[model samples]
Each structure stands twice: as structure tokens, then as C-alpha cells.
Target: MRKLALSDEILLKIEKPARYIGNEVNSVIKDKSKVDIRFVMCFPDVYEIGMSHLGIQILYDMFNRREDVWCERVYSPWIDLDKIMREEKLPLFALESQDPIKEFDFLGITIQYEMCYTNILQILDLSGMALKACERKEEDPIVIGGGPCTYNPEPLAEFFDLFYIGEGETVYDELLDTYKENRKAGGTKKDFLEKAAGIEGIYVPSLYTVTYKEDGTIDTFAPSSSHAPAVIKKQVVMDVTDTYYPESPVVPFIKATQDRVVLEIQRGCIRGCRFCQAGMIYRPTRERNVEKLKAYARNMLKSTGHEEISLSSLSSSDYSQLEELVTFLIEEFKEKGINISLPSLRIDAFSLDVMGKVQDIRKSSLTFAPEAGSQRMRNVINKGLTEEDIINGAGQAFEGGWSKVKLYFMLGLPTETKEDMKEIAVLADKVARRYYEIPKEQRNGKCQITASSSFFIPKPFTPFQWARMYTNEEYIARAAIVKHAFQDQLNRKSLKYNWHDAEVTVLEGVFARGDRRTGKVIEEAYRLGCLYDSWTETFDNDKWMQAFENTGIDIGFYNLRERSLDEKFPWDFIDTGVTKEFLIQEWKRAMNGEVTPNCRQRCSGCGVAKWKGGVCVESKN
Candidate 1:
């Protein structure tokens, strides 16, 4: 029997004891002596949040499948446990074996969001590892970062030894094999890194050097070693159908953020929304086979015995075989008292019908991410959604007995005007009015239209990459305009408006486009008790501000100022299949308030065609 890392006293004291304990259902256990590699995968957040992440689950299942590799899981301890661990001088440990993380070969962290930056430092500090990658010794585990955030890894570059550029399903096997080979050859850490650097999608931060121009822009980013490539190409799995998927995912002892079986219907998105980073980076859009999805759903549902199953995708409605798959799932599991969840679906006739069959119309609220309000604003963002689409969709949902409607929009979009901000309220009011269009007897209840706005943060690898961001004051002012507009609406009682924290948006903007200099701010902030900045209650803006002041790093320099089209970005060293030229064209189009067609409607020549798969090849077939 494996020993527990924490004592019963310590476990009982923590809020969620189940988070620290290992040996959950479906979790893999392996003999340490038998496995050549001991890999620890981390999500760098609290257990519930980490457990919900689909990427970690897929990678965990993939890694543990290798007989020679023993992959375990770890998450940043909660604040209570963090304090106790520090007070007791206890090292952080992985869940599976309750073994110290320092003993692992690789410490792979999935950086899903910018706010989790300080938590990365917390993990390293508690694990008795060097905070900076350069300061680490040979015996320390090699820390690698992956996920969407790695597209602009400059802000966290100094901490991470390396980054995996794209899909985990593609090049991980080759990376693991290379590591084994280097180990057998008795290669040093640096030697292994140099060898790994040659592989596609592998970025060795130490092997690369960056020189800034007089104006703080990246003048040159070149590889210092011959083994490292100048441009690290993003690895993609063209055939997603044959890729590794967890049939029996580890069931957490406690309820997770997404405490349900997740069936990923597809990878990437067809909608070319200008503000979206995922849409740009994950181009072409590949779909998993419906037959295979059916099989996985059955197995996952059977193994985990989860009450609900969610269809995971950037846009579930775009899946070619969605109707067939959803029908299969409903038929296969609906009788067994399983709830089917389909997110990211456009509200249409078929969608409403499908949703009506699966979801309780009265209890569940229908969500519409129009992303913009007015037609002109929608065109600027290439949202491919018009006012008619919103009204018609809302009308359909209302007719189908969905009284509660959740509308999502962005406050400070590029080229946004006061009228655009007011339009958000006007649009919500219009939806409420549409709800009342039905006769008094036909209506479910008073229509509830809840609209939310999040400040736009310019992310790397999108048309918005070169766009400027607003100050906290500016963002809040914009939200205030919308709130004021909501009060003046004819159907004011039915309309509710909510906006995201402007302060958090500003910080996220800085990190989104920030360069290597921002790393100091993160480390200093972590030292100043800035863990869990993503959580609204725990986020300390003053400490983060103090960190910036101490580091002499200017947030405005990273976010507020607009970049020249020719100005090289910090993330220019990596290629995400989508070319910068195409992004520039799209940026220009956005400025002209022109809408670009999606992958199905027309090819805008975004340069993802090189993969020769997904939506790019769907037309030919």
C-alpha cells in the first residue's frame, strides 16, 4: 500500500481533503522501479479547476499509456494547505504515489490562463525548485509549459525551461523517446535540451536570445544554439479521429468545476472571429469521427458513471456529424437518466429542437455569444452574426419555452464607439421586446435578458494582436455607458447588465502581450501573496500594482499603445500555421469594418491549408 503524503490531522484540517489524496477511480498506478520516466503533469490551479481541464486529462491518459512512462497528477494546493505546507516546511507532492514532485523527470504545467501566472511560481517554490529556470540545477525536474497561453510565452519565459507549441497529440511521443535516448546516452540536462530543441514545436527558452529595439519592441529574436530552430513550427494532428482519448478518465473524489463526462466533438473552430485567439491558432478545424465519439461517450459514461455529458468543442454546431452524434447519444444514454449538454451551438431551428429534447426549457437558460451588438461592430470583429440572427434566434428559443436568455458581449473592442457600447443594452432590450412579441397566454413568463460584457484584451496570434487596449478607467466608463443605457430601456425590468472587472482586464492585457521583462512582476507579485488572481475574492490589485512599481515595468508599454504593422511581436519566433501576413490582412479588414467568411463559406487564404486536412480539405471531399 502507498503511504499518504499528509497526516490525517493535516488532511482533516484542509477544506477539501479529497483533493490531496490519490488513488481515485480510474487513476493509474505504476511501480516506480519499472518505469523509465516519472512524469508529473500539473494544471497550476486548485484541484477542482485542474480536474475539469480536458487537455490535462487527454495528456495524462496519453502519457500513462506508455509502459516505460509513469505519469502522475499535481495541482497547486489551496491557500489553507499552502500556508500549512510552508509553515511545516513540507514539500509539494503528486497525487498518484503521494511522492515529492522534485523526484519527477518532467514537471509539465498547462498554463490555461494569464491569471494563473503566480500560481506557477507557488508550485515551484513549494516543490523546493528554483523559481527561475536558469537558476535550477541538474537534479531539478525540467519544467515545461503548454496550452493556448504558450502562444505568447514571453511573459513567463524565464521560469519555464521549454514550451510545447501546439497540440499534445502530435509530437509528445517523439519528445519522450528523445528524452529516454538522451538519458541512456548519459546526456546532461543542457545536452538533452539542445537535442529536444531540434524537434518541431519544442522551444528551449535558454537556447534563444532576444534583443530589443530602442523603443522596447523586439528587434531580433534568434536561436543562440545551432540545434534550436529560428521558427518553431506548431505541431498539429491532421487526423484527430485516430488520436489518443481517455475512455475512462480519472474521477475526482470531490466535485470538479465540470463534474461530468466531456466528449470533445472536434478540435478548432470554423467561425473566424477577429477577436478570438483560439479561432486563429487552431486553424482548419478538425472533427472527430461520430462513430468513434459514440463509442467513447458510451465507455466514458459507463466508466465514470457521471450524471451529465457535455459536448466539448470551439463550436459544437459546426461539427458535420453533430446531428447524428447527438441523436446517438440521446438514444444510447437518455433512457439511463443521463443529461446531455451541448455548448457553443448557434441558436437555430435544429439547435433549438435538439436543445428542447435534451435540456429542460424552464430550468435551463439559453446562451448567445453574439460577441458584438450592432451590425457594424459585428462586421469589425468578423463575428459573422447580425441583429436579425440574434433576434430570430432569441425568438425561436422564447417560442421553445426558454424564458431566460444569457447574452455575452465585449465592452472595449477595437474601433468601438459610445454608440456601440449603448447598442449592447439596446440589443438586450430588443431581445426582451421580442420575447413579449408572443401573445400573453403563449409566454412562459416575463422575459429575462441578462447581458454580460468583458473588456477586450488584445491576444497574440490574432488580428487583434496589434490592437490597443483601454485603461481600467476607460473600460469601466464603457461598461457604465452600457449600464446607463440599460436603465433607459423601455423593458428595463427585464434587462440585466453585468461587466467584468476592469482592473483584472488591464492586468490580463499586460500579460497577454507582455515580453520577458514582465516575468519579474509575476515573481514579485507571487512573493507578495498574489496567488489565485483569477479568483475575484482573492485578487489583490494593489499588490500587483506594487510589483509593477517595484519592477519598473510599464503596463501601458505592453497594452495601451498600438503597434506598427511592421513591428515584430514577442511571439514572432513561433509559427501557428496561420501566417502573420494573413493576420495583417484581417487586421486591415477589421479596420475597414469588413467581414471575412468562415472556413465553410469561403477560404480567406489564412495559410493553414499547408496541413491539407480539416475544413481546408472538406470542400474537395
Candidate 2:
């Protein structure tokens, strides 16, 4: 049995003692002496948040299945425990074995969001590893990065020795095989990375050099060694149905952010929302076989004993066999007391019927992501949902007895106007009015509409990558426009409005479009005690601004300025299978308020089908 790193006394002081304990049911435990490779997979957040992520769970199960490999999990200590660990001089340890992370051969961090940047340094610092990749020697673990943020890894290049640029299902086995072979040959770290770079999707950042123009745009990005591939193509699994699934996952003793069993219905989204990065980067949407998904759902529920199961996808309603899948789960689990949670469904008759069967009227609220206010503005972002559609959906939902509704929108999108912002309030008021239009005797309750908006951040591989963002003050002011409009409604009590932190959104924009030099800003910010920056209480905008000043990199260069169509991007070297020409055409169409049909509706000639087959390959009527 692995010894507990925390003392009984110290464990009593923390908010959630279950987080540090490692004897969770279904967690893998292997003999360290037997395995040749000791891999530590870290999510740079607290235990609950990290445990909730599907990617980490998938990779954890995959890596541990190898006889030669022993993959373990770690997460950043919560601030309370962090202080105690620092004062007691406790090194960061993995959850399964409770062993120091510094002893591991490899440490892989998943970069899910830009806000978690500072937390990366926190993991390294507590583990006694060198925070900078260039400072590490052969004695240190090979630090690698992967996930959605790896799609544009330049901002974090200097901190990570290498980045897995694409889906992990295909290339990780090959990478591990190469690493094992190199170790057997007495190879050095340099030899390992150079060999890893030859893989289809692996990016060795130290082997490349980036040059900047006078205006801080990327002037050139080229290979510094002959071993590096000039272009790293993203790896995709053609058939997701055959990929490994974790029938038994680590069940936390305490409730996690997503406490229920999660069923990933598919990969990628068919809808081509202009500002969405996931839709573009994970193109040509592929789904798991319905029978396979149903079996996995049953196995997962049985192994973990979770009462609720959530269907996870970019858009759950867009799955081709959603109705069939949901009906199957309901029939299989309803008697067993297992509940279903659906996400991002359209307000259509089928959706209303399915939701009515699964959800209780008192406990659940219907979610709609119209993404914009008016039909014209919706077309500008290719949101595809018009005001009439939203109203009609609300009417159906109202008649179906769902009085509570949640609406999502993005502020500071390119070409947004005052009327566009006001329309958000107008839309919320309309939803409430639709509820009253129904007779009081027929209603579940009084109507409540929650309107929430986040500042738009233009990300790579999306149509809005060239779009300029609002300054922190400007974002806050724009959000105020919607809030004030909502206050004007006579039924103000029925509506509740909220917006994201403008300061955090501005910093996220800087990192989203930033190049290699942005690494310096991140390092400086970490040195000045910036950690857990995604948390509202821990984020320090003043310190981040100072880091920019210290590094002499203008913030406006990355975030506030609009780029020319012909300008080169820092992430141009990495191909996500979607062509630049396709994105450019979409950008032009968005400007003209022209809507492109979804993949199932019509093929738009996006280049992804050339690489692998999925939803984009079929002919449309």
C-alpha cells in the first residue's frame, strides 16, 4: 500500500480531505519496480475539476493498460493545502502511489484553457522541477503539453519541451514505444525529443526558432535542426468506435464538478459557428456507434455505480442517432434510478419531448445557445439560430411546462453593434413574454430567464482569428449596455443578467493569439507569484500587466489590433486538416452576413474530408 503523504492532523485542516486520499474505487495501482516507465499525467487545477475532465480519464486508462507503463494522476493542491505543503516542504505527489512526482520519468500536462497558464508553473514549482524547459537537465522528467491549447502552443513553447499537437489516441503509443527504445539504447534527452519530433503530430519546440517582425507579428518560423518535421500534421482517429473506453474510472470519494458518469457521444461538431475554435480544429465530426455507446454507458454506470450519466459532445443534439441513444439509455437505466443529462439542445419538438421525459420540471432549466441577438448578427457569426427560431423554441418549451430558461451569448464579437447588444435583453424579455402568453393554469411556474455573456476571444483555426478584441474597459462597458437594457423591462424581476470578468477575458485573448515571445510574459508573471489564475480570487491583472512591461512586449500587438488577411500566424506551421483558404472564405462570408449550411445540410468543401472520413464525406440533398 502507498503511504499517505499528508499527516492525519494536516488532512483534518483542509476543506476536502478526500482530494488527497488515493484509495478511490476503480483507481489503478501497479508495482513501480515492474514498470519501465513511470508516467505522471497532471491537470493544473484542483482535484475535483481535474477528475471531471474526459481527456485525462481517457489517456489515464489508455496509458495504464500498457504492461510496461504505469501512468498516475496529479492535480495542483488547493490554496489551503498549498500553503501547508510549502511551509512543511512537501513535494508534489501523484494520487495513486502518493510518491513524489520528481521521481517519474515523464510529466505530461494537459493545457485545456489559457486561464490555467499560471497553474502550470505551480505544479512544477511544488514538484521541485525546473520551471523552464531550457533549464532542465537529463535528470528531470520530460515535460510535455497536450490538449486544445496545444493547437496553438507558441505562447507556452519555452515552458514545454515538446507538445503533442493532435488527438492522443493515434500517436501516444508510438511516442511511448520510441521513448522505451531510446532508454534501452542509453539515449539522452536530446536524442529522445529529436526522435519524438519525427512522429506525425509531435512538436519539439526547442528544435524550432521563431522570428518577429518590427510590428511584433511572426516574421519567420523555421526548423533549427534537420531532424524536425517542417509541418506537424494533426493526427485523427478515423473510427472513434474502436478507440479505448474506460468502463471503470477512478471514482472520487467526494463529489466532483461532474460527479456523474460521462458518455462521450462523439468527437467534433457539425455546426460551423464562426467564433468557435473546437468546431474548426476538430473538423469532420465523427460519432461513436450507437450500439457501442449504449454498451459503454451501461458498463461505466455499473463499474462506477454513478446514478447520473451526462452525454458529452460539442453539441449533444447534433448527434445523428441522439433520439435512439437517449431512448435506449432511458429504457435501460430508468428503473435502475440512473438519470440522464442532455446539453445544448435545440428548442424543437423532438428535443422538448426527450427533455420532458428525462428532466423534472422543478429541477431542470432548458439551455439555448443562440450565440447572438438578431438574425443579421447571428449570420455574422454563423450561429444559424434566428430570433424567430428562438421565440418559437421558447413557445414550445413554455407549452411543454419548462418555465426556466438559460441563454448564452458572446459580447465583443467582430461587427457587433449597440442594437446587437440590446437585442440580447429584447430576446430574454420575449422568452418571458412567451411564458405568460400561455394560461396561468397551464404553467409550471412563473418564468425566469437567465442571460449570461462572455467576452469573445478570437482563437486560431477559426474564422474570427483575424478579428480584433475589445479592451478590458470596453468589454465591461459593452456588457453594461445589455444589463441596462434588461433593467428597462417592466418584468425586470423575471430576468437575471450576468457577465464574465473583462480583465480575465483580455488576458485570455493575449495568450490565444500570442507567439513564442509570450512565454517570457508567462514566466515573469509566474515569478511575481501568479498561480491558479483561472480562479477569480487568484488572478492578478496588475502583475500580468507588469510582466508585459518587464518583457517590453506590447499587449495591444497580440489582442487589440486586427490582422490583415494575408498576414502570417504563429501557428501556421501546424495543420489541423482544415485549410486556411476555407477559413478565409468563411471569414468573407461572415462579413457579408451569409450563412453556410451545416455539414449534414450541405458540404462546404472544408478540406478535412481529404485526410479522414467522417460526417463531412456524405452527399447532402
Candidate 3:
């Protein structure tokens, strides 16, 4: 029988006790004495939000497949439970075995976004582990970080013992095998880390050193140990179809943010959006076999008893076999009342037709992400979308019986102007007008056009990595301009506009491109009671500002200045296969408002071809 970590009294005091209890459907459990390694995987957020992440699920399923390894799961406790645990002096424990995280061999945290930095500290603090990796004892778990945010791991470098760069499916087996061998040979923790550093995609920050120039730019970034490579190459799983995927994922006891079986049809994106980090880092887009995806979908739905399945990809429209897959799913499961969700699809005739079959038009809303407002701005971002595209897509959706439309745009993009800001409203008004073009008798009543905008941050590895970010006041000003423009429009009654918090945007910008020096500010902020900074109700900007002041870190140095082409970025040492020269060329093209063709159109020589697979090879063939 499995023991519960929290007492009945403690569980009753919490809001959702189900989050702390284990024994979810399909969750793996093994005898502790039999396993050679005890691994605890964390998302560093609440249970519901963490459960929705597909990356953790895939890795969890992959890790637990090994007979010698028992992988458990943990999440950052919510504020209500966090306080109770601290008051009760209870250490944070994993869900599967109800064992303290400190007893595990490895603590792997998947960092999906920048706002969760403080929560990472919270996890370490609550788990009875040292916040900094350097302060940890020999018996402490080896803390490793992964996911998209690890591309710029310098900010969290002090907190993580090692960072697994790129895809986890590629070299994790080698890392675990080396750890087991080292432990059997009575090797020290540092010895194991040195061996792990030699493997591809493994980055041990303690073995590396960074020197800053007088201008605060990185003067040098090199490895101190022979085992640590100066340039850590990102690991890419060339054949994604053959890789491990979670068919029987652990179902949560309570409802999650995304309560459905997720089917990742592809990895990477062919469309090179200048502002998108995922598009840049995950180059040479790779697709899974359609037959395999269909098998996984059927198996996943059956294993978890989920009523819905969502196709996961950066861009679903780019998948070559999307039509066949969707058709097969509808024919196979539509009668069984299984819902098919297709996100990241480009708005087009085929997309509308496919969506109409699965979605109830009366309850559903059509979403279009123009990214930028004007044609020139769209070209600058390489969005490949135009005014004609937006109006036509909306018109088709309205005709197809979708009365509500959601438009997404970005503020404070590179070279943004007042006219560009106002064009956001103009674009929404144009979309609303397209819906009104239909006869009143044929319409599904007045159309609702809700346009939402978020301030852009200069993320590492993107063409806009060197772009300048605006202050909170400046971002709010841009939003105000767009709001005023909406009021001046002819169809103002039908259009509504909302913008993201400017304060959070500025802080996110700081962390996205920050170096090792920014770690101190994070520590200070966590000390000053900053947890769940991503949540709107919990985020206190004043505490973050105080952290910066206490640490003597200038947010302007990280976000305000436009970086030079020759400037050495903190993330330059991490080779992502996409060459710097190629990024520079794309940045110049963006400045000229030129649109780069997608991978299917032509090869622009972005340096990902060295892999000799995926879209790169497909284009050549």
C-alpha cells in the first residue's frame, strides 16, 4: 500500500488536497529498493498548470520506461498549501512514492517560461534543498533544468547543477548510464558531473566561466574544465517518428488547464517568424509519421479515457499529412463522441472546412494572429500574412457561421511607430466589417471582434534578440493609442481591445536576455516573498523592483538598449545549429521589411541543413 505524504489534518486545511495526493490513473509506481535511480520531475508551477505541459509528460513516460529508474512527479505548491507546509515543517515530496525530493538521485525541472524563475527557488526552498547549487551537500539531488527557457540558462545557472540543452529524447540515456556507472565506481558528485558534461547537449555551468566587458557585454565565455566543451551543441532528435511519446500519461485527479490527450504531430516550424524563439531554435522542422500519430491518439484516448485529443505542433497547417490524419480521426472516433482539437492552424479555406466538422460554430470563435498590424510590419516579422488574408479568412468564418472572432497582435515590436500601433485597431475594424458584409437576415446576429495585444520581449536566439524593449509606461502608451483608435473606428461597438500587463512584460524581457548577474536579483526577489510571479493576482511589481535595487542590477542594461551586431550575447556559447551569420542576415532583412520564404518554398541556408534530415532534406529531395 502506498502511503500519503500529507496528514489528514493538513490535507483538509488545503484548498485542493487532490493535488498533493498520488495514485492518479496510469501513474507509475515501483519498489524504492529495486530501482537504481530515483528521479523527481518538476514543472515548478501549480498542479493544474504543470499537468497540462506535454513536455514533462513525454519525459516522465520516457524516464520511467527504464527498469532501473523510478520517475516521480512534483509541482510547486500553491500559496495556501505552501504556507501550511512551512508552518508544519513538512518537506516537499514527490507524488508517486510520497518521498522527499531531497532523497532522489535527480531533480529535473522543465522551465517553459521566464516568469517561473522565482517559483524555481520556491521549489528548492520547500524541498529542504539549497537554493544555490554551490551550497548543496554531497547527498543532495543533482538539479537539472531543461525546456525552451534553458537556451538562456545564465540567469538560473547558479540554481541549476546542470542544464540539458535541446531535446531530452536524444542523449538522456547516456547521461543516466554515466551517472549509474560513476556511482558504482564510488565517484564523487563533481566527478559524475564532469563525465556528464562530456556528453552532447549537457551544460554544467559550474565548469564554465563568464567574463564581462566594461560595457557589461560578455567579453568571454569559456570552460574551465577539459570535460566541459566550450561550445555545447544542441541535441536534435532527427527521427522524431521513432522517438518515445507518452501514450498512457498520468491523468490528474482534478481538472487541468488542458484536460485532453495531446498528440504532437511535429517538432519545429517551417515559417521563420523573426520574433519567435521556438521557430528559430527548433530549426529544420521534423514531422512524425501520420500512421504512428493515429495509433498514439487511439492508444492515448483509450489509456486515459480522455474525451478530447489535441494535435500539438508549432504550426499544424505545415504538417504535410494533416488532412489525411484529421479525416482518419473523424471517421474513427467521431461516432464515439471524441473531440478533435487542432491548434496552431493557419486561417484558410481548408482549415475552416476542417474546423467546421469538429467544432460547434455557435459556441466556437475563430482566432487569427496577425502578429503585426500593417502589411509592412507583417513583412518585417516575416508573418507572411496580409490585410487581404485577414479580411478573407474572417469573411469565410462568418459565412461558415462563426459570429465571434478573436484577433491577436503584439505591441513594442522592433521599429514600431504610432501608425503601426493604431493599425491594430484598423485591422480589427476591418475584420469586423467583413462579418457585417453579410445580409442581416443571413447573419448569426452582431459579430463580436475582441482584439488582444501583448508587449514583445527580445528573446535569445531569435532574429529580434538584439531588439530594444520599451519601458512599462511606454508599452501602456502604445496600448492607449490602439484603444483610442478603436473608439474612432466606424464599428467601435462591435470591437473590443485588451492588452497584457506592461509590468510583467518588462520583467520578462529582463529575464529572457539576462546573464549570470541577474541570478542575484532573482534570489533577492524570492527572499522578498515573490512566488508565482506569472499569476496576475500574486505578481507584485514593487517587490521585483526592490529586488533589482537590492542587487544593484539595472533593468535598463538588459532590456532598454539595442545590441550591436558584433556584441557577444551570453547565449553565444550554446550552438543551436542556426548560425549567427544567418541570424544577422535575417535581422538585416527584417530591417528592410523583406519577407523570407518558408522552408517549403526555398532554402535560405540558415545552417540547419547540416543535420541532413527533416524539412531541409525534404526540400533538397
Candidate 4:
């Protein structure tokens, strides 16, 4: 690889030129002579999107804090830029130095979602790197992955050398220290990976052999080395208040996933919504101290010059000290020309008070996930919210002067029926009625209720792991029932219904919970111009359908087929700190329409306890 020069002619061709031209305020640039290790922190997406991610920023800041290690950013080019690169015969390079990615000692990519799997392969191909871990020689970069999707890295096990199972903050330092020591002694990539596997949260996939049954399911997962543990523990940083994170995240020039400054007030949620993989995966909620959060927000507002600072968390309202934190940020930053926004909120009247603090200035639409329509349906799914809860939550919002509200729900949850589907309209109607009850003078405006219902995709490590999704016809029929029920209602005039494309949801379900066999669908889909399936424009259902047919596999087998309790799931081997028995118990309870107490009330022993040293939630002494 040669030293590259930035040309305006070339820059004009690429999308979001600011991405490649990396001259951010705090970006690291190292002298190759002094730096012992160079890490290309690659996110398999466009730069604008990846730069918006806080995890990349966190790890970038964490590793660069050390003098010996230098981490740089690399994101997959869009199709146009990718084509131009291929035409120009350009290899993938990091943003900061314009150096080829292969020059780096380590390549760490974040496996944030299953959809990005194809993009991983695309990124590797574009990088002039081997797509498979085994094909690469010692001269190649030692590729590793982390983040939530790594909990089910089996489908992508062959691609990466190693995976950081849980929170990277706790054990990432230990791995770095060991790597620095080993590399100083001229250790090989294999040597470093083998040693890294011994670390608590690091999982070296090469040491494990996955054998599948005739039914195309995992039969047994055997570890070749004693270093590989039967149950790999997930890392959890218990005290979030003390964690090293950026107060001033880089503010992107263009709109991205979340462009504004995001102050993550907490990590994880204890609500234990049965269908939510995030709730199960990111367990044992940890909140930053109120004072620390306020200080961070203030600093971020000053540094980034961002208009809105979103208090980010799995469930922002669930934080015990949310009121105090929000109030403090508002009081301190309001005079400084900063407005607060909450990304996620629980459906509670009390939760609305936190938003009430910023309502006058930051008048965004209210969003809530009732998850299901009917009370019985909600009980079966373990959403733990009654119809009354949502109805009242809406009432409070309307009374509090929020004119528009958005309701989120899923239509294809297990044990769903036409009657339950009809109730979705009823719930939307109820929410609409609450708006008219508001006094005319005090009322903000016409109540706009936007209800979005998506198809349910059963995911691993959730109580619905063994559940089956509704077929295309079933969903269409159910959707019709809901659509028609609300079409004629007087209160529903202000209600706007939006639904997820049933076909895409079906394909998403297949990939999300599918095994390596389904990888063929991904590869074929990408080959047939199915790049950026995450976006609506690039998501071609016909292409996926054709790929499934070409692969000689039934798409329904992965999406719509029910699994027996005895059958081995694709992600059964990958431990997410939650025991199978615990999930099974929850599943049984869900089927029986029994609501188990949340983890905070009683110990469900979801296996996060062992990893976090004791209970998931901290006891107030």
C-alpha cells in the first residue's frame, strides 16, 4: 500500500466527504515509530451512521487514552463509493491517516445487528482481506467483533478470529495489556487469540467445534481446549458512574441514526419484556450518578454545540434517579441554550413528568410501545402493561399538552388472534379520545396519533425463542382486521396507521434467528443487489425470496415454523448470561398467561447475577 493523497476530484465522488476527511477535534493520530499497536475500529456501515454510534466513540477514546495503542476509524463505503474504489483499484483505508486497514495490527468491528452480517463480508472484501478467519495468514490483521449481536456469533463464527462477549470496558483493558506484552515478545496472532480466550469475556471461536444434527440444528458444541469454558461469562460494568466515556461525542454534520449528543444515563433494562432481545441481553441496569450525568451533559453541550441532548438508555424513565438527573440537566443547561430529549420512555404517567420538564421548549411527539393491543395479549407476551396503563398514559400526555402521540406495537406475537388484532384499533381509538377530553384553551392542537405495528420476529435468548412468526397471509389478514376496525371509528379520524412490510419482516425473522445454512440467503441476496437491507430502498423481498428458493431452503422453516422445546436452537451455545432454564420458565409462564415478578422485585436468577458478582440490581443500603 502506498501513502494516499486526498484529492478534491475524488472527494467530490464519494458520499459524505466529511467521513473520509477525518479532522475531528479529538481524533487520534499516532507516530508509527512510537505506537506499538494500531487498531482499525471498523464499523461495517457508512461513516455518517457509524460515527453516530457511541460504542465506537467509547472504545476509540478508551484505547487512544493509552500512549502505546492508536485506534482509527473505518466504515464500509456506500455502493457508489465502493464502485469508484473498485474502478480506482483502491483498498480499504482508515480515515485518520489514509493508511490501508491491513497496516493495522488489530481490526475490531462491532456486530450491532444481524443485518450487518453481509456488510461485514462486504467490508472485508473491500478491505482486500480474507472473508474467512482461517484463510488469513499471520500477516493479516487479527479481526474481532463485539456488541449485542456477538451474543449469537455462531452464524458469523467463521468470519472473526475472536469476539468480546459482553461489556468491552471491563476486560478490554486486560486484553490490550496482554496483547502489548505478547506483541513485545513477538507473539503470533494465534498466540494472542489463544491467550485472549482465557480472559473472562473474550471468546475465541476457533477453539470450539459446532456439530449440527440432521435437522440442521446444533447437536453439540464441544470445546477442543480446556481454555474454553462451558459457559462463557458476559462482562458487566456494575458501576457505570465511574466508567470512561466521552462527554463530548463527535457531532456529525449530516443527520444520522442519532446525530445529536447522546448522554447514556444508564445501561440495560429490568422490565423483561419477553419478546425484547435487548432487555434480556443488556441485563442488570446501571445508571450514571445524577451529578456526574449532569456534568457530562453540560460539558457535551458546550463542546458539541448540539441543540438537543438526548438522555439515552434502554428505558430512560426506569432509572431510579431520572427525575433528579433530568431536573438537574434542565436547570443547569437551560440558561446555556440546551434542550433535553429522552430517546426511550416507559408508558407511565409518572414517566411523563420527566418529559414534562422539557415539554415547553422541546415539544416532540410522544412515543410509547404498548407492544400488544388487548390485555390478555399483553399478558401472554409479558409486556406487563395493561390497556388502562397505555390509555391513561396517553390521557396524561394529552392533558400535559402533547398534541401528537406515536404508539408502537407488533402484530405477529405468539398467541395472536383476529380478536386481539381488532383491539389494536380499539386501543388507538382510546388514545385518540383522550386528546378531545382536553380543554380547548389548554389543548395544544389537533391530536395526531400515529400507530405503527410491526411483524414479530422470534429472537434467541428471549422467552419467545421457540415461538413461530405469523405467515404472510396470516399477517395480511390480521392487518386487514385492525385496519378495517379503525377505518370507520369517529375518534380514529386523527389516527394514522403505519405497518411494517410483512415480506421484509418475514425475511428479517429468517435471518435474525436462522443458522449458518441461511447464510446462503444473505450471500445470494447481496449478490443479487440486496446491499443495505437495513434501509427500505435496498431491502428487496423478491431478491430474498429468490435467494431462499435458489438455496433450496424453505424460508418458512426459519421464520414461520415452530420449534419443540427439546430442539436445539441456532444460538443455544452462545451464552448471553441468561440460563436456558430461566428463559424456558418465562416462556412457560407467558404461555400460561402468568406474569412473573420483575428481576428487581425477586431474583429470577437470569445468570447476570453470577457475572455481575451478585444481584443484577444494586440494593439501596
Tens-digit lDDT string for candidate 3 (71-94):
999999999999988998999999
Q: Each candidate: RMSD to true structure?
A: 1.1, 1.4, 1.1, 2.4
Query: Candidate 4's residue-wise lDDT over 354-416, tens digit each?
Result: 677776723578888888889988898878788778878888887877888888889988888
Error of 3 at 150 (Å): 0.6
Q: What is the Cα-based TM-score of model 1? A: 0.99
Candidate 4 error regions (>4 Å): 1-6, 347-350, 360-363, 610-613, 618-621
Clash pairs detected, candidate 3: none
Q: Candidate 2, after superposition: displacement of residue 180 in Å?
A: 0.9
In model 2, which runs have C-alpha deviations exceeding 4 angstroms?
A: 612-615, 618-621
Q: CA lDDT of 529 in candidate 3?
A: 97
> Best-fitting candidate, measured by lDDT?
3
Ordered list by lDDT, greatest first:
3, 1, 2, 4
lDDT of 2 by residue, 83-192 (tens): 89999999999989999998999999999999899899889889987888889878789999999999899989988989998788998999999999999999999999
Which TM-score value belongs to model 4? 0.94
Q: Please give the distance, in angstroms, between residue 194's alpha carbon in candidate 3 and its true position after superposition.
A: 0.6
- lDDT per residue for candidate 1 within 487-522, as digits (tens), equals 999999998999899999999999999889899999
Model 1 segments beyond 4 Å from truth?
611-615, 618-621
Better of 1 and 3 by lDDT: 3
